[model samples]
Target: MTYFFPKVRQAQQHGWKGQGNKAGGWQEMSRVGAGARLFEATAVGIALLCLGARLEASELRKSPVVRAVERASPAVVNVSTEQEMQRRPGMFPGFRGDSLFEEFFRDFLSPFPRGQARTSLGSGVIVDPKGMVLTNEHVVQGASSIKVTLSDQREYQARLVGADPPSDLAVLLIETKEKLPVIPMGRSNDLMIGETVIAIGNPFGLSHTVTTGVISALNRSIRTESRVYKDFIQTDAAINPGNSGGPLLNIDGELIGINTAIYQKAQGVGFAIPIDRAKRIMRELIEHGEVHPAWIGVEVQSMDEALARSFGLQGRKGVLVTQVAQGGPAQRAGLRKGDLILSVGSSKITSRQEFLEALSAYTGGSQISLGVVRDGREMEVKLKAESLSTQEAVRMAERQLGFTVDAVNQASKKERRAYSMSGVVVRSVEPQSLSYRVGIREGDLIRQINDKEIRSLEDYQTAMARALRRESVTLLVQRGSYGYYLTLELGGGG
Candidate 1:
């Protein structure tokens, strides 16, 4: 076969043709057979190359990260909002006939100019087929108009269904005749650290951007200047300004958390609200348009050096129970005054603030376990929370303060004339009560409870209900021409 191919190539190069001679006919026949064999060999090589290339591409496309992004992206949305900016006038009084001067000083005096609109961009995930989108509350806060752009480039007007500022979660509704794609919800309570996670959002106004990272930590707490946020899902994924309210998905393409950019100084550190906590708040928002405060009827105070020593804490951290409401969840669960609460569920309680933060994750009827140290013995007590009511709040306040109050308008003519203010007036005081021992007297006008202003009877009730969650409340009391700020310990009274 080799000898014939060489002879055939040499004969064809020399212009040999099969005209009439037998040698010419043999050369032509050999050349024809060799040419057909060479063409078939080349075709086989080309097919092998194509098959190898296809196999490599198929593996890359089947990657877990790639598949997760593909499954979740369709439910992700770009949220843009428009808000009217309010202008502040100059501090000085208005002057006439000084148009030029006013114009010159406008830039220096006024905080902002009128008739300007502010626009913001963020991300959202569709959690329901009915077009209910979930995002951060700050994304749509004070928004005059909101617009949502789906991954398919379909735009629709969105209206706020409900917003919970404390949880930083909001729900938006977009009415469309067709059903929208939704992301499957996953539990955050069992999320493992260092697990792969994906973040999809509209960072810097770019829509449907995807980033990948692992869960950095769980049950993390982040503090800002104004307030502290707890129970966050910390991740290494890049969460920028517009990434707020985006979905944080696990490797299985399930929604585990809602990404948040509250900590602005983060370099590789990003935080999110755990889906387990968000789920309770979302249900409340969808049903009642707000998250109601849950009460367990126990007042806790921060442990001080003296109190810590008295309770034999040594160096342990916990809050001291100052009071437990009668016939309430805490009382029914065997919780008592002077008991030190070491923890709430799995979270250790060091201060009153931390205790409140832990309890905020739950709603009414939630059964929670409390770790307590009673008489130097450690024990766990379980209690169920109840929705706070005005009647219960008033009863608690009366028993704790040992004082009964009436609205200022319902006071006697002489008392009203003497105390002309918008607050609640003490109608009677228990002689042997803590309030009485602290120099609180009848006819005292209560102007504020903790940080809440008391302008009406409803305001007073609401303030007392919130104060019930704390171990002590500071009251701003006005008596005669003098005013005083008194910190009163709640619970035990005459």
Candidate 2:
């Protein structure tokens, strides 16, 4: 990568004396050649330019990452992993299922080879003095031979302590007689946009390379090969292919982020896992070897000003429960379809992410109180949260049109101020549920059944009993404030 400079041209006719110079009496000219003068000037200019570039390059080489790597390289270790993978010549194309090339290539080219040792390399941080290390999960995804290289050039076999792929964070442990230098963890929340950050990692097998840049953005969502990391701290830090699992530190020498991914097509944009989220996952992994999150089994949506006004909500706050899964904890506790969830226990949940964060903070089987608004009535419901089987959860998520009703009562109207209605409102029909398949919901409001006009719970029961008697029945339904008609529907299928 050499850069060429433009060739300087010499001025002609240097033999003739200039009028400005002292008059020469046609004597042997003392005047220097223009070409020589141009050559000398060009040499001096080139030397000055070289000196300036050297100074600039020197300054860039001494930047923050360069400085941090010098100080923290001792704690950063290289990891080599070996894993075992399935090998079958028939499983691949251009294979006879019996060739040595196929068999050997399958084993040789894999990150995890069959029966033989497969090697991978990445960097790690020895965060604990007791020899606990932090690295990316991808580094040890299926490793069989894990090695750690210290700054002193000593290599030691390491073992996986725990790993969480959702956060792309992993922990390793090794035995040593002496304590290793640890990087101090810092609060990533204190980071501001444009604040300088340093990335220290082993890039392209080049150990202890440092790159520096200011925080490009905060709370970024990044998609990587490992996981979809949300709330990442984006920076201009020069992270390359082999920089995974390295630390992104603040100026005060504290680990703020974990260098994880970079935008391949773009320049100066990189992302790191925020230290706070990583620490939470690490604690769970190191302590329990698995993370157990509380499951409420309800679909919630954020309440915006428009939705709040439409729902006639008091203060445009709290997460709105859009749909409660059948047989879930909320459903078992009598939580209905159109309830506005005010809070879970003492903490107020404002968004879906906040709800998930709050829920993940709690252990499974914890009983919590839920504040909700039903038909404009504020009530407290005690929900004993339980983790449901995957199959059961999937089943519950599908029964959306099993029931239909309208917001008719005063309390229901006040709670659903957005609808601007006084009664239970029938919004939409779920396709696969019993009601929609039998022609229900969308505009049908229960006016009455079997000669009785349905107005409340008692009236609804009476109408339902009569309608159930007929395989297909008709019910008096109100389409608007004044219009009413008979809506026939089939029963006994759910």
TM-score of each: 0.77, 0.53
Local accuracy of candidate 2 as per-residue lDDT tens digits, 397-440: 22422555554656655543323342235545677766666565
Please give, for residues 1-494, the per-residue lDDT of candidate 1 as tens digits: 13245656776677766555778668667677878688778788889889989998998778898888888899999999999888665454566347775676666665555576889999999999999999999999999999999999999999999997767999999978687999988988788898999999999998988998999888898888645788998999999999999999999889999999988999998899989888888887888787666778887778888888887877767888887778889999999998988988778889888888788777776778999998888999998888878778888788778998888774452764446558888888999998999988888888999777898788899888767655578999888878899999765210
Model 1's alpha-carbon lDDT is 0.84
lDDT of 2: 0.66
Model 1, which residues run further than 4 Å from truth? 1-52, 90-111, 304-316, 375-377, 394-405, 408-415, 418-455, 463-494
Worst 10 residues of 1 by lDDT: 410-419
TM-score of 1: 0.77
| Candidate 2 Cα misplacement greater than 4 A, ranges | 1-71, 90-117, 224-227, 262-266, 294-299, 302-310, 313-319, 322-494
